[model samples]
Target: MAEAKAEFEVEFVGACPLWRGFEDQLAVALGAAAALEQKAGAVAVLLGDDERIAALNKSFRGKDGPTNVLSFPGPRVDPGFLGDIALAAETIAEEANSQGKSFEHHAAHLAVHGFLHLLGYDHDEPDKAEVMEARERAILASIGIADPYA
Candidate 1:
């Protein structure tokens, strides 16, 4: 199989402070993944407060509230690289606090999660969860973050 030409672009659209070296780390994560065939389009990362994200959640997924991260795969997922990833600042902060992890760590984990989604990984089933999480663990380890499971 041909190596993926993964391309990444991250944007912070709200008050969330950009994590240290996050962009670089995200690029590394994209580079490490073999399944997401990267191409020309950028993978946008937007950070918003609860209200903004909640609206998006409700509109797109039919959920009633904000989520930590939402992945909107571009139309080209089947033949090439995936699309956009949106993250919520408030949710991420709350989740990191609740999970006893650093903000950077949780954000990194989410970034990996979003990227994996772009690669067609989903957690809707036990077997799928296993496969996706394993890939996440490996990629995150390469970036110096601990296994999200442990």
Candidate 2:
């Protein structure tokens, strides 16, 4: 059988130079999940800096400081217009260094994670977290990445 298809686009603002070819990377991360879910759509990813993400975090999430990744899901039923996902460059770099993973590896994990969130995947509880993480691991693995949780 032929593989399913999904569409995605990347939008970088701020100082995230590492997002040069991120569209393909994100497609890889989203591929298996999209195929399994049988959903076709486009996602807008913003690779921003700490300061920018922090402001968004504070304003939207009512939190202080920057976070690694944030997802603003669009109308769930409208797969054609999935919302946006944002990433913090500084936070991503720092976390990758601390976790002893490459920037690309960590970023792929984040992309999968945020994209999943846009697809209504959440980790607010143990069971849900397990399912989400498993999906993430599987998707990443399919794309030649390792299990991030392990």
Candidate 3:
């Protein structure tokens, strides 16, 4: 059987690019993740500040603050659609700076993380988290990203 293509879209709000080619880089990351996970469908990504993401976090997740990333499974999933992922620019930047990593690399890792969530991977429990993190490590390794947990 043939493989299914992964389609993605990027939307920017709140803040602008601190890293050049961020959107393109994200596409490459998502594309690679999609291929590795064998996911097929559209996923939307929003790059915004803490405020915008916080609002979304509140609305969808019932959280009170901004998070680094959030993933929502698309309703029409099954035969095609996967879901969407959102990232907070301010939080990502802060995390990258604090972690001594580049903004692009951190953001790319988050993008991969979110994409994996959209594909029905979760870490709600220890066993599940280990499996998910292992998959994450493998996927990120393929993209030359260091193990996030280590």
The Cα local distance difference test for each model comes to 0.72, 0.80, 0.80
Model 1 per-residue lDDT tens digits across residues 22-92: 55655665555533433344566666667877988999999998999888887853443367777777788
Candidate 2 Cα misplacement greater than 4 A, ranges: 1-15, 21-23, 76-78
Q: List residue ranges in candidate 1 displaced over 4 A.
A: 1-41, 77-81
Error of 2 at 18 (Å): 4.4
lDDT of 2: 0.80
Tell me the deviation in Å of residue 127 in model 1: 0.5
TM-score for each of the candidates: 0.78, 0.86, 0.85
List RMSD in Å for every model shown.
3.7, 2.6, 2.8
Specify the poorest-scoring 10-residue window by lDDT in model 1. Answer: 32-41
Q: 21 in model 2: Cα distance from truth in Å?
A: 4.7
